[model samples]
Target: MNRKTFLKTSALASAGILSRPFITYANASKYRVALIGCGWWGTNILREAVASGVVEVVALCDVHEAQIDTCAKELNTWCTDKPKKFKDFRDCIKNAKPDLVINATPDHWHALIAIHALNNGCHVFLEKPIAHTLKEGTAIQKAARANNRICIVDFHRRYSPHNVSGMEFLKSGKVGRIQEVRAFVNYSGNGGKQKPSEPKPADMDWDMYCGPAKLIDYHSGIHPRAWRRQREFANGTLGDWAPHWFDQILWWTEEKAPKKIFSTSTKKIHDNIQTVPENQLVTYEFEDFICFWEHSINNTRPVQQGENVGAYFHGTEGTFHMGWHGGWTFYPHGKNATTIHEDPQLDLPDGQNIKLVWADFLNSIKTGELPHADIEHGRQATNMSLLGMLSNDLGRSIIWDHEKDMVTGDAEANKLLTRDYRGEWVYPS
Candidate 1:
């Protein structure tokens, strides 16, 4: 089929408008799939893949035995065959010989697993922010290119229908020349005091879980779900949520990376619950405009009235708010100009957009075309967040040379581009 026809068919399939499955192969063979890091979101991606009816999961890998068991039980209910389980990803990849590998590990493990899978001739579906650090992200991109493998980063907003329409509206100049962009998230229910570290659970292989990252004491607050708040394991809220918003801004502006970035962060909660900052403000400078990122852990008030977590496009003609589940709205500059609003077709249970993203990945694998959020795009978005975090850590603004992929004239800042891996877990080149 042609490009337009393919896109239309894919969209229709994603929206459940088509009567048949999104993919139908003439032969009986199905794509062999393996899932590493059987955590909450990882399993969610696996679910979409199984639901697609185009792939068979052959292996499940996780450092935690409980997680593997739980995921296996769910897969048993969804599929006819039981998948082999492994604690080591290398064994899973070698033994399962999967055509596609779904990587849902923490940010720290992203680079290692993705590069390994790509090198072993597997198309990778990697969860975002592409890696724990800037260099790691770049390495994953290189691995994909060098191996000539398909790599799709889980930046699901790129596939959202309302987001697609919003981009079309922005490109049409309805919002006029954009001057500044703001991305923010303000919510409650985090920050108080740190939870006490507990003895490691028997079901979890803590050493394997901390591969490549510093091995820290096991805390319930830092595992299973709350790892995002810990600096050792992940990049906190900015690293977790900013990739999606930064991705939206980059997609809308068609820019690769910001020229200069400055940020300030504060840990107001003064708790062990989270080592990362609770409040952060990052400013990114481009040639024509500026982009700002702000997030707060316990502030429930919306950034702009009803919108809690999303981006705002400030233009000469008007302002646009691209919300998560709240939808999109546009306000014109003139005194009597009527505001335009579009309600979101909510992706119930969250991560529903993964289905559409999965369809795109499958299509790309079949057509030999790049997926919607390719590894390069994922690297760019991941770098933006990493740059901001580096600036906040250094307590100053830093210039970035995107072409060279380095921080300009800042020795200390540049040194942080790639961190030293713990023990034998080598950092990807």
Candidate 2:
């Protein structure tokens, strides 16, 4: 269904939009965007940003010279000219002087790059899991606030039409009060082990790739996608995927920072890897509701939404299932399950939710309004996953004092909330 038809028939029609618009205080004709991290996802952002028609991509930044060169050449295939390529992020921002930087680097580099971009007086479109650590996430948010800049975290699910409709329906009270939420991700492990340390590739700057984190030996197994499993580089599967699922549930329920969290996990596979869980389960408690999230890299269990990864929200009246692929369904307590339609155009080539997120960011820049997936939303989601990681590490439950934003009465657990950046990288004061 189209947007209008869906809105008119939606249960939330009278309840109002899932996302509230920010008051715009500025005006701009077009935005200049510089993209960092020319990996698979990064290149896609470049294409979509160009397609958005609201920005011009002036620079492509990546530590891997080969990756950035490939991206620049790819852009040349369609456009008459390609963006300038840079190995160092600082140089990209300095020379390009873009109004916005699309940061798709790994989790560890997010905060540092974003803070620098903000220092240069540029807005930022940062990818999920705001930073490698909770402290960095907060710092990134503060930098944006201090600079009076727009920072939109790429929690793409928030821009999903069907997911938005599902949230609206829940808000309308048709399903009664939500009592619990369950999210799951069951995927085959990416791969196993690495090819040991070797000389760094000529086309890559290994030191730059390890920015902010300790410089580990180069290994072929760590690059491309395996980096998600590394503790020092990424947040594992929980950090990589939970942001999307958790972000949806939190936004749907309009909740933040669970009061308590407990989790358990094991590294059944890839024991030699320095990454996170191979399988895990976590439970979070709110004032009136509860949430459960689990994942097994080696299992393909039957899921609530018939999709490998999704969320099921249980309520008094029935249950709501939202898929990562962009569709929602309502299973009434006693009645038959019904499918809900959102904007059908969401399936178009450049009309996917990620593109919509870009559109929202672009609109936010032009109008000086906050994007639908704001930094705070991203921070909450990231914090939730980080809490789960902490619980697993401690082998116990964590009592969260949200107001103070720390783990209560546990010095050791609290210390894990932030990381000590290595080399020249330092947390901004």
Candidate 3:
């Protein structure tokens, strides 16, 4: 950011203190929160964030009436005063004056909405894959730094105690010198087009639903539900859940960005669109180990013996397999079941991890500290996911210059690393 922009933003931030009212101000109300996009994953966020009791749901915004009604009813029951409602997030932010804005919106809206919330002096809780691409993710990192707000990305697996323990095992070299780490995420849903449902409700603004993406038709079924199939709407399953597994991968390695990645996917429906592969197998080269990701939208489980849609740390000692859940098991490196640790009854305060994640953010707000999975953490993780996306697109292995943040072999893939803002939307700071 330029000096002038920094001074202007700092001045504006300082001047915002004068506008606090006894009713809607930050001090009187306990962390008023506005939620944008009430979809499937969004409901999870709404329930968890509301249930956290550290904040109040002051505003609700969704493009669809049914979802809006459903989430609002759930939140209204939890909130003391009726939470304000708006179809557009802009109006919601302007009127409600929330202390925090939680974005469960699609990938495309992540950067724009989160930055806006930060610029408005609201702490932001953003869902993963920080933005659609690397460029936007970097922009968001700068925004978090300049705005100095507690911006936490929802990589909840990172806050899981089991996952943390698993990482500790890797760090301890219990698995010996790590040679390879294989991860898998094969699912049945989240690919292909959906059967057309009835027409969308008249109350819906399909244009706004499209957002920065090029405009198309208004299929109610496609508007919010199967929108994941479209590149403009979602980043498919990779963006959908790779962050969960990647959390384990990155956390275990304690590595930021990998050196290179090459990927291939199932035959695509449209070659022009930047759609994530339905069945992509990405080989990412790291400093110490080679990480293989088996991502598909078809199989329920792994296809190969060494690959079961989980994190596998293959070292000189032994192998460990950990999927989405905390249930992780380890076997002695070369020997058979002589040394295995699988604690089915193990329950080591997973809820405490969640509490710690939020309490850390709240404490960060109080003491200018960066919360767990802060913006840069989100950027690095999201960068890994985007590399997979790019690898799938190119159908070939690609080298990366991490410091400069680009793929060396393909100019075309580099195009997706960043994006031009559609309209007046600017990255904060």
Please report how far candidate 2 places residue 25 from its true position, in Å. Answer: 27
The residue-level lDDT of candidate 3 at 74 comes to 65
lDDT of each: 0.86, 0.78, 0.69
lDDT of 3 by residue, 1-429 (tens): 233432343334223322212222223446788888887667656655554455777788887777788887666555454678788899999999999888988888888888888888888888887888678887777777788788988766665545555666778877888879888776666433445435667878776776776666665445566666567766777777777677778767667778889777777544222345777777889888898888766667744543345688888888887744335677674435565543322213332233334544565676676766687778887787788887776667778888887778678888767656555555332
Among the numbered candidates, top TM-score falls to: 1
Best by lDDT: 1
Error of 1 at 62 (Å): 0.6
lDDT of the structure predicted as candidate 3: 0.69
Q: What does candidate 1's lDDT look like per residue over 1-429, in tens digits?
A: 344744685577566622223333313437999999998888889878887787878899999999998888877766665679999999999999999999999989999999999999999999999999999999999999999899999888887778878878888899989989999988766644676778988989998898888888898887898888889888888999999999999989867899999999875666566878888999999988999999987676654565788999999889999887777889889899999988776454663478778888888888888887899889999899999999999999999999999998989999999999999888889
Off by over 4 Å in 3: 1-29, 189-198, 268-275, 302-308, 334-336, 342-356, 420-429
TM-score of each: 0.95, 0.89, 0.83
TM-score of predicted model 3?
A: 0.83
Tell me the lDDT of candidate 1. 0.86
Prediction-by-prediction clash tally: 1, 1, 3
Which ranges of candidate 2 are over 4 A from the true structure?
Answer: 1-29, 271-274, 303-305, 335-352
Per-residue lDDT over 320-416 for candidate 2, one digit per residue giving the tens place of the 0 to 100 score: 7777554677777765656544433253344445666676676667667666788988989999999999999899999998778899999999988
**Runs in model 1 lying further than 4 Å from the true structure:** 1-6, 17-29
- When 2 and 3 are scored with TM-score, the better candidate is 2
The order by descending TM-score is 1, 2, 3
